[model samples]
Target: MAENSLEKDYLEEDTQHGRYLTFSLEEEVFGIEIKYVTEIIGMQSITKVPEVPPHIKGIINLRGKIIPVIDVRLQFGKEPVDYNDRTCIIVIDIDAVSVGLIVDNVEEVLNIDDEAISPPPSNKTGFENRFMKGIGKAGGKVQLLLDCERLLKSDEMEIVEELFEEK
Candidate 1:
């Protein structure tokens, strides 16, 4: 009776919020909400935008659309690595702008329970912590869930504008 109804409600909630797309940066796992993801493409040639920040790898033409690409490794303050077969570009849309994130490789979509997500550790050191929304635990490993909107805010893009203004 009441017990059965409660179980059904829990299952429904779980189904609604139980999916994430996991990817790797360096040796750590990270995830972004799947809903924002547009597509994943293999590495491609990028045209450098002069005077832009180093993290901004450059722009890529996708089906007649030019999208800026960011090397997540550089964004995270790691030494840049050469693009290899496993490298990929993950297209995502934030605030109506489509951008591509260059990642080492994408793992797979995971169903992580909402209850398993914990707030970012207060003591974490480095710039990486500022980009993390929370930490999700699954299969005994931690996935640093990113706050995409914060990570891709206009403040950082202002640097790009400044570069163009100087030219």
Candidate 2:
């Protein structure tokens, strides 16, 4: 039974590898590793927290668990827009931390092979490459691959950790 369980876990990980959950933030599209995604939900009433960055929208009580949400558009330095029916919150778990990413809308799960990914452009171009894992080209389109672990700065991560502890 233990061997079976291990095999199952390995198979699941193998299947999820190289797959990405694609979402949009305006005209630009982004992709995050599918393995980190927990769930996708419609916009919910967010209880705002204080003293944090503006990009950190707030927290939402998700079936009893409180998850901090970040507005991807604001985080990427884009103008804020009204949330419509198409807006979605993508819940993801990174390094045991669960958080929600508010995006314009989710596109689809794409299987992008490693060969289809390329390194992001140099930061000298005034582009923030730290938040990006790579650039994925597939299906005749390009998607900015996000580095989930680097999405939050170190100090912001402390705030998120504290929020989880307090709630």
Candidate 3:
């Protein structure tokens, strides 16, 4: 039984090894490891929370489970735009905590090999690339691959985790 479980785990890892779920934010595109994604939902009514950061849009009741949603544009310091038909919420699980990322629109999944990935630029120009894990080259285009663990800082994660515990 243990051997079978091990084999299944290996197979799952192999299939998701280089798979990425791409999404667009304005003109730039970003990718997240497909393994972390739980589901992609359309824009829904969000209940605003007070005293939270501006980037945090608020929480949503997803089938009785309250999920905190964050605006990717606001999180990246970009100007906010009205949510439209194209808006999507990508629900992801990081470190056992689930959070929803509000993005402009979700693109198709792509398989980017390790050889096609390049490290992010140095953080010497006062530019922030902390959320980026690497840059993926796919089909003649560059995709900024996000490190979901780093998407929310430790402090922020704690706060989000608390929300999960509260309910």
Candidate 4:
């Protein structure tokens, strides 16, 4: 549960302020800006697609929308674990395209002040650091703030798009 703090304490920028939907990945808390979150759905049957990365769990037809789901654990390079009742997808709009993020469990939406967020560590040499928008501190808890736009890069986005298009 002790996730590494991304950066040193810096001046809080007001632009980061807003409601964030926090979720659990194991014990670590992660937050995605609520502006991009569409809704939360229980883990349903996901039709696996061929030739995509393992992290890309494949697509789901929610009512009618075909949204690709990515295992956040796998995306973070963590060991794969079994999905339980608490497991669900946080459907978010990344640059307008809807995608589902499979999280260990969904917590609640939190109103994180800009002052509570710290910049991502400049010293990190890992890929995960690239996706971090900042580290959020609220209610004495730390939440890894994710940059939704960067969650899936242009090329990765293209890959996800093609997964279902090929069908």
Which candidate leads the pack in TM-score? 3
Off by over 4 Å in 3: 1-8
Query: lDDT per residue, candidate 4, 1-167, as tens digits?
Result: 23333232222343345789999998899999987889999999999988888999999999988999999999999999999999989999876688999999999889988889999988555545878999999888999999999998788899977765754
Could you tell me the TM-score of candidate 3?
Answer: 0.94
What's the lDDT for candidate 2?
0.95
Query: Which residue pairs in candidate 4 collide?
Result: 6-121
TM-score for each of the candidates: 0.82, 0.92, 0.94, 0.85
Off by over 4 Å in 4: 1-17, 124-127, 164-167
- Across residues 1-167, which tens digit of lDDT does each residue of candidate 2 receive? 99999999999779988999999988999999999999999999999999999999999999999899999999999999999999999999988999999999999999999999999999889986899999999989999999999998899899889997853
- List clash counts for every candidate, in order: 0, 0, 0, 1
TM-score-superior candidate, 1 or 2 = 2
Ranking according to TM-score, highest score first: 3, 2, 4, 1
lDDT of each: 0.83, 0.95, 0.93, 0.88
List candidate 2 segments past 4 Å from native: 1-9
